[model samples]
Structures are given as structure tokens and as C-alpha cells.
Target chain A: MGDISTEQLAEECLAIVTENAGKKKIKAGDLQKAMAAKYGDQVDRKDVKAAIKELIDSGKCVYGYFGGSSIELPHVEGSAND
Target chain B: MADDLKIPLLEELEKGPWPSFVSDIKSVADRKPMAADLLRQLEKSYEDKRGYWKHGGLVGVMGYGGGVIGRYSALPEDFPGVSHFHTVRVNQPSGWFYTTDALREIVDIWDEHGSGLFNMHGSTGDMVLLGTRTEELEPTFRALTEKGWDLGGSGSDMRTPSCCVGPARCQNACYDTMDMTYQLTQNYQDELHRPMFNYKFKMKMSGCPNDCTAAIARSDMAVIGIWKDDIKVNQEEFAKYLDDGFNVQEFVVEKCPTRCITVEGKEINIDNSNCVKCMHCINRMPKALAVGDDKGFAINIGAKAPIVEGALFGSVIVPFMKIEDGDYEELYDFIDRMWEFWDEHGTARERIGEFIERVSLATFLEGIEMEPSPKMVKAPRDNPYIFYEEYFAEEDEGEGEGEE
Candidate 1:
């Protein structure tokens, strides 16, 4: 929405997921909140969702349900989804 | 899969007077291999006296977090086809009205990668496809999405909003229940798909107090239709009903909790101010009585089953709010205020109803920035609630009196 396509936004989200992969479980809600902070608090939740969907649809990311739900890098070692 | 399989335990369930899911699954089993395996697994459960399905870890389509219920068979070594039988929840159309083509498409897709078992509508108002492998999650999602179908909520997400058939069938509906339900579902797609809250939240709408959907006893948020003006009455129709041997005492008079309706000779009169909008009079004498012209909705929050404590019926949050067809900013803003507070304070798996109980309704009201209303409570408290503002004000006044 902010002059960036959903694909580009998805790339940013992918980086956030990868960066926070080991430290914390970055959930879909967490991803939007984190990206909003990264982009000077300017991010639409719908746009973020579109980006996240692109990540999943493209097989760059995957959803894991551990108590609740969270997004993660695909095909990672010791991952539960496999 | 076998040419001749014997499921003695499951076959007994098909004998009941009520329509049986056992029979329904058997029909599906004839086509889908996984469904056949599912029947076998279920039969084993009845024989063994224990369920084989276990779910804890995550399994869903590539991007989406909700709609898929991840379940793995504990007895996978015995039944391989039903091993990773996760459930896919397809968001049902508002009022559950679906065309033949839409249903055929769903059935076709399920035949491809699913167990072919379905719940006509789950508790959360989604058309639930019972079983599928984890690997098929993406493909299943793709097929549904391509055909303009979307998934419903699950796992700490906002459950799909449901409504009784309003303008579609019932004439008592003061507001358009389907439109409101669909609008909220579409607008809150992000909240519905993701775990926005710490726990699950359910929203159910009813067109009138008859509450065919049972929104009052079940959902976290309930939108029930109401009218501000007097009940519309036709005296001639009222006489006609009574003259036709309609039992006035047993049907209309007794059914009204408030006892506002009075039968004078042949005509029935309603004390509009005292009328509670129970809709019994209107239901019994549809030709004679009707809902008022000034229509709106009565909003209630925090109704759920016993979990943290005993069951809590929804308490009225807003007595009435005009729900404009296109603009619902007031309603959305009120919900936003509630969510802001609940999201900040509620612990994991704690419901909004439980939160109100834990913090007391007074504290909950303050948290949500809602003013105290007489309509919000069933009766006056035995010991009146000591709100923070009133308590502080009393203390401040006491200081001056003490000094004197």
C-alpha cells in the first residue's frame, strides 16, 4: 500500500520471520506488528495479510499450529509440519 | 479398503430414528478411500472404547493459520489412509444458503484429496470437511479459493459469524441478519484467519428475540434484533385470531413474560412501554401483531460455557444501536474498544466472559470505557459495585469532613 507491492512486502516479512526464527515464534499477528515498527509504523493489516498469503502461497513460508498458530520458514530441520 | 468390511459397532448407530452420520459416512466411504479408512478407525474406537484422533501440533495450508484442524491418528500403523486426517472448515454462506453448483464444487474438491466426510455446518457455522492429509492442505485450499470459497476460523482465531435466516424467510427479523453476519466476516478476514486474540471469540447474530441461533447462550458477542417504537397492532386481526378458537390465555397471554398484553372482549391491547419485546404475541398472532417501525439491534457480550467458572449468559452491553446498512462505524468502534482492552489484559485461553467475571463487570466496563447502564444487569447487586471513580470520590470527600 505504501508504494510497495505485496510481493516486496512479503520479502520483508520473510526476512523478519528468518531473523526472528530462532529467538521467538513470529506469529501472523506478530509479523504485522513487527513490520509496522520496521516501516515507521506505516502498514495496513490487510496489506500485511496479502503479503503473508503470498509467502505461504509461494511456499516460502508455512503455518504451524502450536497451541495457537504461527508462521515459519518452510522445510526447516526439526520442524513439526513435516 | 476391502471388498466386504464388517463394522458391527458402527452399524448399530444407523438404527436410530434420527438421521445418522454413521450412515452418511458409509455412503462417503463407498467412494473415498480415506473415508472408508475413517469408518474402520471409528469402528475400532467403539470396539476399543477410546478415540484414536490426536491433535496438538500445527498443520495447515501455506499461508493461512485458521480453517484447518490438525489431527493425527494415534492408530496410524493400523489405518494409514486416515493417518494425518486434518479437518478443513469452509466458511458457509450467510444463513447457510448455498446453490447446487457451489455444493457440487465443494463435493468435487473433497473427492480429490479429502476423506469425503462433512459436517453440514459446524458449531461455528462453517461447512466442515472432516478428514484430509496434511500434504493435501495446500491443494485443498487452492481448489476452494479458486472457486471463490474461503476458510473459517479455528485455534484461538475469530470464529465465523453466523445468523438465523432473516429477510430470507422469517418476517419477524427487525434487521438484516445475513448481511450483518457476512459483512463482519468479510471485513474481519485478518482476525478470522489469524490468532488475533489470546483465545477464541465467537460472534452470533439473531434477527429477533426468538433467537433461533441461540446466540444469547453461546456466543462471546451477540447481536440480537430489537425495535425502539411500539409494537404494531391490528385490532381486527386480533379478533379474528380469538374468534378462530385461538387459545388466548395459553398461547399469547401466558407466553409474554411481562404480561403486557391484555385481552379486552375480542381485541388485544399491548402496554408498549412495559412490553419486553419477547415476540411471543407476534409469533402467536402474526397477523395481528408486528415489530415496530424503528428497527435496530441490541448488543450483548460475554456469554460462554463453564470453563474458568460457571456458565455466564450474555449481559447487555448496548441497549440499542442503529445499524446503518453501509456504515457500521459505531458498532465497529465499540467492538474495537472492547478488543483493545481484552487483548491487553486477557490471559491465554481466557474468554471475554471469563474476563468480566475475573475483574467484575464494573472493572470490565471501565476497561472498555463503557458507562454504567441499568439495562446491562439482570438485577441490582446485593452489595453495590464500588467503582474506582466513586470509591476515590468518597475518600476525597471524607478527607474534608475528617479535617473539620
Candidate 2:
């Protein structure tokens, strides 16, 4: 298995959050499981975390860590202020 | 005698705090009789509410149709200066910076040709020679051009683009604004003189965040400087500001619209997390705040006088684009695209912005081959949230298949 790039990680993360839209609280474990299914041995815990960070920064995903990490698909607002 | 005689005006008690233009005119009037008579007539007109002379004619310096604006009267004897009372707009050099020699050359030329009296800067940033003759227009323009000077905007053409002193004098400048202004002015000379458009076009440029030239309000086209990176905060300087009795609670932390900055003890921390790069903090503390290394400009569109439509504020079009080598091809391409679009769809008197609003920003974007950002909206209050309706439709189709 090969190491995944940040761009690949970001795409995977976007797919996961987008796929599970409106689902009650997607967890870090769920993301890791999804990554494992897609990349098999290529994906790691650190790669998933970095990808999630990038997604949040780009306003593509919104997440809140309440003890167990839960993330959700972020809606792209029409206006910049939103 | 009473009807023929003119009144010697007395100085007013409260003529405001500023220095008197009347006095300045009087000083020049003493040296030149023609200027003296012109000033006296102007003063009389002010008192009588009637003009001493009518204005119109082709006036230039020597061999050209520009430079000196000739205000001639057929009744020249009645208005002695009327024949020679032409306003000369001396072509100001690019960036308008002058050496002592250049100043002397222009002043000497004006004094010799017509009035010693002059307005240092005219409405068009040229030196306005206030009184010359209709015939002198050609000679005056010829002489000035011969001396390596020329005419500026007069009719419906492109007005000279003025800019604040960029990298030369200002620390905040991201590019050579002055050079760019001159380049555009020189490149589009024909457009600056001919009245082809429905109305006049104005261009203005500013160095950085601080718009010294007031380009935002004054010009049809304004190029403002901006950067595209995280704000640079000097921790040591910020600490000093805090130590020097600066109001961290009120000014820095509380004043931030984004609530991005927090002060803990003497150290100030900015959560790059929320910093919008609005330059508010940088404006507050010039020494402490620096912009990010990634430099570029944000292009704004549709800023013009409210002629056809009601007054409209400029809207941000290209939020961020790189500027390099003073050769802004992207800007030129954008302008060309805008012109083509507006000229095709616009009525005789309609402006580009109004035309765009009439059509749509979406159409404009498609024409220009740029994707609409989330920031782009029809109005200021449009909803931003996007749920995948297409994806939902696909999901519904899958569910119907399961039902089958």
C-alpha cells in the first residue's frame, strides 16, 4: 500500500461527509473505516485527520468535537458572510 | 459716468480661513495688464451676476489643436483680454512628478505666449493657462509638443489615470501604481481625446489598503491594491502596543469584526482561523501589522456616476488575481471582455454595470470563462446554503427502484 497525498485525502473526506449528509453525527471511527474500505492499507489515521482539517479550512466541511469527534457536510452558503 | 464706471471692491471681513484666490490673482494682475483686466471683469461678473465675456473657440499653443484652450470674443476691444484669455492645459508628465527645470520650462512658455497668470493644476491634472487667443491654440500646442510635452483629455475620451505615490513614497504599496497609470494613459491616448462613448471614462489607481487618491469614489474604473494571505502580526510590536497603554480590550480584540484576535497577558494571539484579512488592524497599527506575502489585487466593476441608473457602489468582481511585471494582461482581458459584452447589449447611454445588472452576473461570468464564487450573488441578502438537490433526486430514484 502507498501513502495517500493530501489532495486525495481531501477528496475522500469530501466524499464521505457528502455521502453521509443529514446522518446523525459522523464520527472519526466512521471516517477511518470509510478510508480503510477505499484505500485498504494505504490510508492511515494521521492522513484522515489532516484531510479533515483541510476540508474545514476550505469551508467544504463543518465539524464539532464533543469528546468523540463528529463531522458533517457543510452547506456552501450563497453569500460570503454566510 | 456712473453707468460706465466700475466699482472698486472692498475686502470682506470673513472670507473664510483659507488664503484668498483674489489676492493671488491680484499679484499676477500687477505684472500683466491683460490679466489685470481679466481679473477685474471676473470680479465685476461676480458682483453683477453677469458674465463679461462669452466662451468658445479652437485654442492651442502654436501648431496643435490642443494644449491652450482659447476663449475668444468678437468684441475683443470691449473685453481686451478676451482675444488672448485662453486656458492652456500644459501636459503634465506621467506620475505628475516634476524637476525644477521642467517647471521652469512650462512656466516660461506660458508667460511668453499668453498670460503670466496660471492655475497650477487644471481639472484634468494639466497646467491650465487661463487666457490665450483662438489662433494661438495651434502654435501653443505645437511649441509644447516640440518641447516634448502634449495635450491631455478634453472631450469624451479616456481621462489620464492618476495614482498615489506607490513604492516610492508609501510602505504599504504592493505594486508600481504610478507607472501602471502612466502606461495606460500613454497606451490609450486616442481614447482619451475622442468622444466615442456615451459619456467620459475615468481611470484611477491606488497603491495599497490606504487609497490616497480616493479612487473608490472618484473614478469610473478603480484599481485597488490587496494581498491574498494570512495577516502578518508582529508579536513583539503588538506586545509593545499593549505595554504602551494601548487599549487591547477596546481597540484590538473588541474592535475586530471577525473576533479573530485574543490577548492573553502581554502576548497577543490571532486565530488565523477567523481572520478575514480586511486590513482593519493594519490600518490601526501600521508599524505592527503587515500583509501576507501573497500579493495580488481585487478587481471591482461598475463604479461610475449615476447618470442612467441610480448611484451604484462598485461591486467586487475578481476577488483576487496576481499582478506581475506591471503588465496586467488579465486586467486588460477582463476589460476587453466587459467592453464587448456591454457594447453588444447596452443601449446608447447605458453603462457597463447597468448593462450587467440588466442581463446577469452569471451570463457575464460565462462570457469571461470564470466560475462564480460563493461570494457572487444577485443581491446582498441571497441565501448561501446549498443542499444537493440533484443528489437527492438520484437517491429518490434508487428508493423507487427498491419499492419495485
Fraction of native A-B contacts kept, per candidate? 0.42, 0.00
- What tier of docking accuracy does candidate 2 attain? incorrect
Per-residue alpha-carbon lDDT of candidate 2 for residues B62-144, written as tens digits (9 for 90 to 100): 21222334354444566575445657666566556889988787778777766767776764466666776545556666667
lDDT of each: 0.78, 0.59
Give the B-chain TM-score of model 2.
0.78
Alpha-carbon DockQ of candidate 2: 0.01
Clashing pairs in 1: A65-B58
Sliding window of 10 residues with minimal summed lDDT for model 2 chain B: B379-388
Q: Put down candidate 1 lDDT per residue, B201-231, tens digits, no spaces.
A: 8999999878788887788998888776778
Which candidate number has the best DockQ? 1
Q: Which stretches of candidate 2 lie over 4 Å from their true place?
A: A1-82, B1-10, B13-16, B50-78, B120-124, B257-259, B271-278, B305-311, B343-371, B374-404
Q: Against the true two-chain complex, what DockQ does each candidate achieve? A: 0.29, 0.01
Model 2: how far is B311 from its true place, Å? Answer: 4.4
